[model samples]
Target: MTVDLVVRGARVLTSQFMVEGAGVAVQDGKIVALAKDPHLPEASQVVDADGKILMPGAIDAHAHIYDPDYTHREDWRSGSEAAAAGGVTLLIDMPLVLTVMPELARQKIEVGERESLVDFSLHAGMMTSEEHLRRMPELAEMGILSFKAFTTKPFLASYDYIEELLIRASELGGRIVVHSEDDQVIERGVHRVRDVEGRKDPLAHHDSRPPEAEVVAVARIIESVARVGGYYHVAHLNTARGAELVAHAKARGLRVTSETCVHYLVFTKDDVKRWGPYLKMTPPLRTKEDVRGLWEALLTGGVDMIATDHAPGTREEKEIGWDNIWEAWGGIPGVETLLPVSMSEGLRRWGIPPTVLCAALCANPAKAFGMYPRKGELAPGSDADLVVYDQNLEVEIKADRLHYKVGWTPYEGIVVRGWPVLVTVRGEVVAQDGEPVGRPGHGEFVRMGRWR
Candidate 1:
């Protein structure tokens, strides 16, 4: 029987090891074979991947796409196109869901099915009320098994509520994801920065949500989840203290995992001096020392993955920060640059092997979110989601070249030494040479099981 496609002449990188000079065979949207060049099966379609490193298409664990609610900032098509261009095959969006019941989940899934160019998943959240808490099992049955909560505002769930969330979710075979920051500490710091100090500087944003706040919140969640004996993931961890806390929890077999964003790894508090409000993210950029600590944790296995947290804000929304940092939008666009930039920097600066990148950017995230075996592996029976990366291509990031509704990138002018020359999802070529070729509606909504 003729296979649908054959991809030859590249090094295959996976979580455990690299298969040098291997080829992949695909049929019916699944990987059917992986072997050396001459041993690969002849197929209906043959694609050359010479001089490239082939790996599983990245699964972005965190993204924000507010379609009908805030389409001026982003939508499914625009967001997923950016993801495809970046060699990401899946996007797990974080809507900051205040209450994710069946109707709301189905409504968003319908939107994604109609408009996306890549597979997608949703994270339900906010266990502040009995109504919200009661939906966990029902939502899990529908495949939205990961729920999110904020330790601080705009939708804060108190520590008591979060502990209850951890217990309840574990009982129902679900996961709890938290945006960690201590509310009271943030309140005091905000008063210090904006009211007492009368500072509206970009750095003031960092000071207003200090590292101590993250440590406090992370510590509370990790320990609380440990007491209940369940899975917990901390998002966008920015401080060395936070990393240390997560590392210790992991050492104790607490079943806790955490992720850090590319911004935290690349930029720092010092960058605010130049980039100003563009660097303003919640759990804002930390010191260079904190950056080093995050890198250390990542390298040592204390940190499990790296995600874009790809949120975008219009120029008008972000530009207001130059005059009043407090007023500028808190997010920046990143989905388009996540893979290319991270692969380039991770290899060039930190000696991170391609296999490690595959682990963090591909496999580990899939395992954490229960998309493994199907979406994040290159082995047979997995979806033929692949990225062909050229280690030698050098490109500078320019906003015009990126696919964000926002017309700016904080990474503009930073040259990346490598790029994804081609990308595919489920055996179909979706992007090539930095351009997205995938069509809207080609992507389907992905259902997930809770990962134990």
Candidate 2:
């Protein structure tokens, strides 16, 4: 049968392996066939990949974009543009910056339908209070597949609250994702350095959020999950010890998974000293040894996936921490560079196989977030969202060339060898040559199913 489009002459990544000399046929916004035999079906359109790699579009499961309160930093339109430019076809947004109540989640979904250029979903934020916890099942019934919680101040949930949320989530068949950090440990660290003159140093930010804080919180959350029996995911995990705790938890068969961002695997505390607020993120960058351990974990299955944790803030907002480490915004603009940076460092420098990278950036995230087969696979019946990557395209990253409203990137000047030249979301080319060609409001709010 004739198809809508065919992408030929590329190595196509499937769930099991990469198929060389393969072509993908698309129809009605879904994959119809992965052609390997000489004879091919007639199609209305054909894209010659020219030996580039054709894989399912990357799904960033962690990102903050277009909080109604922080539109100056990033909005849904701009954030989706950046995601398209980075070859991300879908991004699941974190709710910390946005309203996470059920009504707000519905409102954001409406906004995304009118503003985003890529498919998206939102996680409901679990608050520390009982009123919010009472709304958990309502949020789940509204199609939010997961809830997000914090264990540190400004967003911290009490241990009892966390336990209640976990139990409720288990009952609702919903998952919980957490920004795990021990509030008390961090408080002590802050108090220990509160009067010290050295507290002004950017490294002091790292000091305030020690690795032990994450390790302690991760262990606590795992135990809570084990006791309550629900699917749990840790967001933007930063330390090796934290990874170890997740690994051990998984060994016991607790429905737990964790992910680390590109920065944590690429940068260390040394970068915080060099780039200051620009490099600062919650949980902070760790030691070089931790970086090594994270990479090892990625390769060894200790980590489930890699995400951008793409939170962007204006230069002025970041500069607030220049005189005092505690005052700066704690995020980096990364959705536009996540794939390129990881491809360069993970594949070109570290010799990581492309299949492994695909699993981390595409497959694993889809599976974890209940968007698999539809968003992360190229097999027949899956949505035809794909990225055409040229592994030899060498380029230096610069904020001026990026699409973030924040106007800067922590990865500026870093050279990356591989880059996405063309990106398609559901059989339509949304971006090419690092620029988004799709219009605002073209994207739809994706409703995720329950995770098994």
Candidate 3:
């Protein structure tokens, strides 16, 4: 049977191994076959990959597009456009506010379907109150099995609250994803830095959120979650001790998984002086040694996945931090640069194996988020979501070149390789040569069917 398309002459990174000269054929938006070119069936359209690396599209499971209310920072269209250009074909849009009810979650999903250029999944969030915790089953039935929780300021969910949330989610066959940091530890640090030390500099942002805060909170949560048979993930884990904690828990097979953002691997608290408030982020960049530890965890089996945590803020919001870092926005744009930076730093400099990188960027996240073979593998039944990377091509990153509504990037001026020359979602070309060619409405919200 003639297929819809075929991509030939590439190193295909399937879930198992990389084939040096591989060809993948697509029919009806699903991968129909993956083999060497001569073994593939005829297709209506054929594209030569020119011996580049063909990988399953990367998935950013921790994106904050902040849509519906905070589109000035980023919207679904801009966020997914950025994802498509960065070789990311899917996003798990974690909303800034709590969306507990299924009806509200469906409305947001419909919005994403109308505006996103790449496929996405929704996260029901901010598990703050008893009433909201009661709504977990509703979201789970909608194919959303992840609930958001926080240990620190704003959502300060008590251990009792978190434990109950974990229990309920476990009962519903769901996972709890938390922003881990000890509120008391952080409060003490803030008092020490701002009140006691009287420091308002950019470094104060780093100092106010010390590694101990992360380590303490992670330890507490892991110990608590492990006892109740709760499956939870540490979002944006950035500390050396924190990585070790996850590694140890994983060794025991206690149903723990964690993700580290691309930024944590590349920068440290030291770089805070260079960029000032621009370097500011929650769970601030850790020490050089901490960055090293995170790399080891990532290359090993300790860290389950890599995420963009792709939160962006405008320049005006960041510039004010020069005077008072407390006021500057705490996030930076990352979705558009995720793959390039990852390949350049992780694969090129650190010698990370392509297979391991693929696991971190693709398979593992999909498996955790319940998207699995359809979104992660390069098998016959998988969605035709893939990227053809020009591994040798290099481009310097600039804010103007990005599609973020904020018009800025923390990675500005760094040159990166393995930029996507072609990106596809469901057998359709969505981006080519660093530009988004797909229409906004081309995307559909993928329902994650939980297998476990």
Candidate 4:
């Protein structure tokens, strides 16, 4: 068979290990060979990759897309465009918007198919209604990997309902992604702050939804999963204490895993004063020690992956100095900045190995989310999703330079080392330098086994 392209490189990250001074041969949309001297007998095109790292394309594993009315922050087109520029070839979108169910999930999938510039997947949510719960098997039959549930409210499912949902999902051999925050603890904290400070200080926003709440909720969620003998993943664990709880649960032989966002790894509570709304993610950023804890957890293998938690609510919804903390919407728009910022600041300055990046950012997420060898690794039979990195490249992040609809970034002034010079999705060069070249609707939905 004639290969479509060949990439000769300094280093290529493969499933088992890295290949130095090797070449990757691709045919159709799959990698055909990664050999030291294999002849490209049927090669059609070859690209010289001197002084660059060729790695598996990034899998963001978390995001929200096609949130049109709400997407002044980020949408399918802009999010995938940003993902391509960030070296992310595939991204899994979360379900929690006002429109969320199997049909709505499929509609969003259709919207993403029309707008996304890279490969994508949609996760159906576990809603509070019995009708939605009864449709679990149908969703599983549809090949959605996992069901998402939140332990807290406003729009979250209750503990009783979540437990039942987890049981049903496990019965259907599906995974569960949960946002674990003690609703009562957060509510009490909010009430206490409202009584004392009357929401005068914006910092009280962080103060009210304290880290202890996350700790309490994480432990409880782990126990609930343990009781059901189900696989449960904690999303965007923001504190050292919460991560430690997850670490403990995993050590206890429970099938528990957790993630920390780039913001938690890079920013701290002090940023709330200066960056305010930009830093206001749910389970907000903690102290410098918390940052240290998350890093140590990643290095020591406690944390499973890194995700953007890429919730892109608009600036108008995030105004600070509100008389009530509840009035200020939660979350930050950040999918576009996730990789470059992490590589430049976290990996380069902090000495995090590229293998760790591959695992947390690519491999582990793929395995956990059921994308596996297809989307996460550079090996035979894997989709030809690859990124070429110019490690020595430096760029200052400016709002105008971002591709996400949310034009601004929290790390706007941070000079960053390393840039994705080229990106490929399924053997096609979709992004070059700083621009996306792929057309809308070129991206296709990827399906996973019920729990694979």
Whose lDDT is greatest here?
3
As a whole number from 0 to 100, the lDDT of residue 368 in candidate 3 is 88
Off by over 4 Å in 3: 98-100
For residues 1-452, could you state the per-residue lDDT of candidate 4 as single tens digits? 66789888557764357667776888988998877635544578887778577888887777876454366667788889988988888888886565366777677778888988899887777466788788888787777858887777655777777778778888887778888888989889888987776765557778888888788878887888788777788888888888888888878888777878888998888987887766666777789999889988887666888888887656566664344446676777677777778777767778877778778877888888777888888888989998888778889988788786656677788888887888899999889996888888888899865552
The TM-score, computed over Cα atoms with residue i paired to residue i, of candidate 2 is 0.97
Per-model TM against the reference: 0.98, 0.97, 0.98, 0.95
TM-score pick, better of 2 and 3: 3
- The digit string of per-residue lDDT tens for model 3 on 1-452 reads 88899999999985579897887999999998999978988889999998999989999989998877578999889999999999999999886755546877887788898999999998787889888887877888888898888898777899889999888988888888999999999999999999999898999989888888888988988888678877888999998788889889888888788999999999988888899988888878888898788888976666888898877888999999999998998888899888789878988778888888888888998998888988987999999998999999989999888888888889999988879999999999999998999989889988766535
RMSD of 1: 1.2
Q: Relative to the unseen true structure, what is the C-alpha lDDT of residue 269 in candidate 2, on a scale of 0 to 100?
A: 88
List, residue by residue over 200-289, the lDDT tens digit for candidate 2. Answer: 778887877789988998899889887778888998988888888888898898988888999998998887767998887887888988
* TM-score between model 3 and native: 0.98
lDDT of 1 by residue, 1-452 (tens): 67999889988888888877897999998999988888898899998888588889998899888765678888998998888998999999887533667777888899898998888888887556778888888889889888888988888888998998888888877788899999999999999999999998888998888788998999888879777787888888888888889889988888788888889889988889998888888878888898788777777766788887877788888778998999998988888888887888888887787777778889888888888889888999999999998878889899999888777888999999877878888887878898899888888888887666
- Each candidate: how many clashes? 0, 0, 0, 0
Ranking by TM-score: 3, 1, 2, 4
